[model samples]
Target: MVRPPHLFAALARGWLAVAVCVVSADLAFCQGADTDSSSGTVVKAENREVSARFTPMRGQWKPASFGGDGPVSIKKTESGDELIEMLAGDPITGILWEGDFPKENYEIRLEARRVEGFDFFAAVTFPVADEHCSFVLGGWGGGMVGISSIDGNDASSNETTQYKEFETNRWYKIRVRVDEMAVTCWLDDVEYAVVPRGEHELSIRIEMDPCLPLGIANFMTHSELRKIEMRKLNVESGSTDPAAVKVESKTEQAN
Candidate 1:
């Protein structure tokens, strides 16, 4: 049986529409949430360009006041680098991401440097499943570094604690990985803290309650931040797996 010319034309148009829809679905995931049974991770995609920018605008990212916090501003350095400047507070100061982010199997990266004062300058509080914990760098008088409130102990006393001398006005790359098994941190690619999740209860102290879900704070220290990024970790690098990127439609069964 030979199909009519009009029928062939209609089928071709339908196929074109289906192809466009498939491509759109893959890109649309960058703004939505999905889960893969293979990894059992709830991955939330994001537009990295917009998500990583720190312009200090309300609603996207806001300055946090943890008790008499100093002023927060954005400054462009001589090298054309834009950085978020957080002045030291009396007790604590920081900023919070006023947006939705991934809860598990995620990584947060940023560049930070201590400008003055003598305490934590790059402390980050992040989510772990339903609870939260903070990675303290240059805390407890500018040397202690670790994850806080592990099994009810603060970073100053947790099993993940370490001490290192940090010079003023020196930038360091910070990478934190939160996965199903552990919460790990590295400063300038040096592994500093690693805490397995199965045994210890991850939590934050009472003073850090305002920075819940996602936030950064400094304890009597001023600092600058650049190139802050938060992204999900389930997606493999250079992966072309159709199962994850392509969305199939019911075209063959159509009548």
Candidate 2:
């Protein structure tokens, strides 16, 4: 009944992973948690609770009426996954998550795939306290990633601008974290952008006004979106807990 030291270490690692996934019935949610930022700052994504989920069961994701946008619909895939599909958008197409969401200390997670076009496929607009901004994915001729309008600069011209090659028809995991301090984005576990909130003015373009507090859009692109979930985070920093602040009271005052 003897075991090697390496075997014991392997078992310990396995148990640690299981402990992390115990937060949700869907193991993918925990396994796919986002962390870190482009600035090399560590971010803890565990111990959070799911706040909102945009799915067929929710019945609140509506096609954005951005004038000549595409046809959008919810359909069950061959794999039995429910997804939102946007097709044939002349210039822009989008869907709005028609529900209240946290303005700060929350995370947005989704899977997106470009079916056609060479523009951004999953541009997520979310609230940053009183204002709103967007995480543009596969934009600017299909390879730019950044937040829209930071201190009056578009994603293409902002400090958070980044580039990553994207393949059409391939699903990409995307996560965005909006905390009291900064807004960070991750693409497939790779840190994409991180912009401090206080140092910059966060906003969306006039074309993205309809998105408002929360929504996902495409720029002349046909795309499929699925498993869009919003999560409320608890941990903040080592010295101070983010939840210690009266978030509910703060929200009411802002409103």
Candidate 3:
């Protein structure tokens, strides 16, 4: 039952080809790690060498036009958008901004800090409605990050996963991944929610708004923030995990 020498050589060559293909695919993923379509990955903006910045203001959209309800600044990049340096201890409701992302998934990254009086609030809003949108992921104080859809006509329904703690004055990183039929939020690399995509009309743009109230018990009454950033990654075809280059872990200490 011994195989012929030529047949064995052919089989060896085929095995070698398969090995080469596997190696090439791995390298491709490493190179295209920022993509999110095929995989669920969190890519770092700084790793991409994006050097963008903008200033902040109150009651109006920042020069970048990311909106909300508070005193804040905006920075937008080819990859995505950001808001930062939110004034703390103000009794205002905070702010909100919008970006229209059509029928595609996206990656959002931002930083937040809670100071003394009021708790800090950070959110990734999606499923944008006419006058409002749902809170796909958000955090208040040291509580778990909450997920719920909000609109002018519907009551909020919480998505199951939750991100806990998140202290004051310490900068924390937040990321959300939205794909065809699922949405997930992560705080410092820890996953909070991974739920089936909700039923809402797709809007082409996403708006970011931070609410700052000048009164007590408001979104930014006791919060301070900075270094707000965002980046975009084109997900690779037929991939199940996010494409990401291994940058230093932004969430390593949060756990």
What is the lDDT of every predicted structure here? 0.68, 0.70, 0.38
Best by lDDT: 2
For model 3, the stretches where C-alpha displacement exceeds 4 angstroms are 1-70, 73-83, 88-92, 98-103, 118-120, 127-142, 150-163, 198-220, 236-255
Measured by TM-score, how close is model 2 to the native structure? 0.72
Cα lDDT tens digits, model 1, 1-255, are 101111001124434321111122123222123433332322322212222223222235678868799888866668665578899888888888888788876778788999999999988899988989898889988999888888899988866777889999999888777766567677886556666556678889888987888988888888988777765655333332211221112342252
TM-score of 3: 0.47
RMSD of 3: 14.7
- Model 1 stretches with alpha carbons more than 4 Å out: 1-59, 76-82, 235-255
Predict model 3's lDDT versus the native: 0.38
lDDT of 2 by residue, 1-255 (tens): 001111001124435333222121222223222333332223234333222333322467898878889999998778666689998587889988787678877778889999988999999998888999998998999998888987788989866777888998999998887777567777886556666557778889899887777889999999999877766754335412121212222234367
TM-score for all models, in order of appearance = 0.67, 0.72, 0.47
Q: Which lDDT value does model 3 have at 63?
A: 22
**Model 2 local distance difference test score:** 0.70
- Residues 1-255 of candidate 3 have per-residue lDDT tens digits of 101111001124434321111122123312332433223333543335332222222233332223334455445545444334445423333444333233344455555656654343544444321322333222344454444432222212243434456555676666655554345556665554444335542221122333211111124444533444344434334443332222323344254
What value does the lDDT take at residue 218 in candidate 2? 96
Clashing pairs in 1: none
Give the Å shift of residue 136 in candidate 3. Answer: 7.9
Which residue segments of model 2 deviate by more than 4 Å?
1-43, 46-57, 77-81, 237-255
**Clash numbers, per candidate:** 0, 0, 63
